[model samples]
Target: MSKIIQSFEAKELKKRPFIIKIADRLTSFFGSISFLILNLLFFVSWIIFNKFDQFPFPMLTMIVSLEAIFLTIIMLVSQQRQAHIATIREELDMQVNKYSEREITKVLNLLKIIAEKQDIKLDDKELDEMLNELELGYIERKLEEQLSEKQKLIIDLSPLNKS
Candidate 1:
């Protein structure tokens, strides 16, 4: 318990957005060269085994079916992981910046007020698109700032560090 508390206080975990985590995991799983090797091995083994004089076709079919099932599971896991990331991003999009519900709501209200002040004549669809684009941009900028700060801290810790 104390170690866990210390870890949290240390804040050593990378402060990446959930979407990034999903992308990394997906890339690691499906984009890996090992996956390609495994696939190639599976294909070659199936073909070679099938060319035998007493080819056990039914057994081979069963093996292939099992492989398909496992492949599907892997694919589903990757998909769900990505979907989880998207869900987190969507939620974060709704609530990031200012760190308080009231402040966030105030910001949204202020944006509406500014649009009104400017007499920004946008249709509902256009307005929604603009608002979403603005929010995404804000979040992206925040992420960049955080990354820069993290990089600086890491550099400061190194012997040859120069900022």
Candidate 2:
């Protein structure tokens, strides 16, 4: 039930930027006079002769077709906007969480401190050699284990009932 409501709300929100504004402008442009005139014409036509059907299915189909075309354009624009926003967010996050060089330096520093605590004092040259060896070993092991478990991103939106 909640999912259904959310879907409806999302559709409505997307259409609001397109249809709702048009509706508002249309109402203000025509005023109540045009509305009453349209109804009066409809009422006279109805009294003159009966329509083909009671439910006006043909008119409903025409409306649905027109709306579908507009809705497609609106959905496309919304999707592109969403994708652009996502890319910007990803870039911002990358800048805020950059850690490649920092992480490498941290690992080296931690090893240096551990060596010092063990009373194994080393000169600058020796410390640098140790750091180099550790870095090489870490890189080798990490390269061997760098198999990403993440799946490729998919961008598919199709109805399940299609055959």
- Winning model by TM-score: 2
lDDT per residue (tens digit) for residues 5-111 in model 2: 46745664466566555554554534568856975686566545656634555664565588668656655555655565567556655544445555766788897
Task: Compute the lDDT of residue 74 as modeled in candidate 2.
Answer: 53
Candidate 1 residue-wise lDDT, 13-127, digit = tens: 2554575456556557766898789878976777686565345567667777997786676667656655765675556555643245456556766788888899975457654
Could you tell me the TM-score of candidate 1? 0.36
Clashes of each: 0, 0
- The list of candidate 1 runs beyond 4 A from truth reads 1-27, 30-33, 49-56, 97-163
User: How does each model score on TM-score?
Assistant: 0.36, 0.37
